[model samples]
Target: MMKYLWLGLIFSMAAFRVMAFPAQGGCKLAQQHQITGKVGRAIHNAAQAHVVVRANMLEASLSNAVQAGVLSYQQGHKQWLEVHSVRQQALAYKQGITSHELKQFDHKLDRVTLYLCRH
Candidate 1:
């Protein structure tokens, strides 16, 4: 009788452990998914902030270039219109412009547009 009780207790313990494993696995998976979602949100927010800062910088640089006589009124006006269009699109989509394109515009404004302007 003693041996039979011991065997029953051992079997119940084994069954309990088996049942607990799936619950632990589910908890771990849930935690991992929550962490991944938080990380994704952080990345998206950072990207959006970067886009906003770049757009503001580009607008300020264009205004400064015009004020410094590096660009003609007509050229500056045209560039400002382009910037406004990009800003509108970015406001709508949150990622309409890229750093590479912004760099290209900056380079053109610095080198080509300045060269074309009269003193």
Candidate 2:
């Protein structure tokens, strides 16, 4: 009777261990990090695109205001010009174009977008 009880206890412990084993491909930490990295980058890019579009629209409205004399000539116009330049840069970056024997402009665009999101 004593031997049978010991064997049953050992079998039960082994079964419990098997049932409690971790899932396949251990190291959940690394997988989680990778998931976070991808999500962060995607969020940053989306944010950059959204902000750039809003800024561009504002610049366009300012230009329209200048034509209609709703805003002073230089004030809103200057702001619009600046935003236009930034929008151009962003568009070029989005296009992934290279110029003047340099690396693609998209690289800088991606960096800027990421920076904006981080801030």
Candidate 3:
């Protein structure tokens, strides 16, 4: 009985930590909402709102990088360089680009674009 009790307590604590994990998994559901919601509907508006909210999320990740001196100006420049290169490549491949690949490329460019706009 005591062994089972101890195991239960350990499991509870582990479960708590697992549940506290960050929101990477959250994005899939959010994206689903964005896709299915009507263009001018309230859920659609909320989906759009998520975009702005997610942008600030970078503050936490980027601040940590900056504080650790990991996100140098050169790194930012490199990001911009990659964005340009990807954009040109994406355009050249426009005819063959699948929606999934295009969306992924756009996501990368969007991140760099936001970083550039803010800095």
Instruction: Give the number of the best model, judged by TM-score.
Output: 1
Between candidates 2 and 3, the TM-score winner = 2
Task: Write model 3 residue lDDT over 1-119, tens digit each, in one string.
Answer: 99999999888766644433133432243442233222232223333333323333333334433444445757644664565565445444423445575456547645654453343
The clash tally of candidate 3 reads 0
Per-candidate TM-scores read: 0.40, 0.34, 0.32
The reply for model 2, stretches above 4 Å from the true place, is: 1-44, 89-119
lDDT of 3 at 81: 58
The whole-model C-alpha lDDT of candidate 2 against the native structure comes to: 0.42
| Consecutive 10-residue window with the lowest summed lDDT within model 1 | 30-39
lDDT of 1 by residue, 50-115 (tens): 434444544555565566555667876777666666545444544433556544433443343233
What's the best-to-worst order under TM-score? 1, 2, 3
Clashing pairs in 2: none
Which tens-of-lDDT digit does each residue in 17-67 have in candidate 2? 443312321123233112211113222353345435444444555554455
lDDT of each: 0.45, 0.42, 0.45
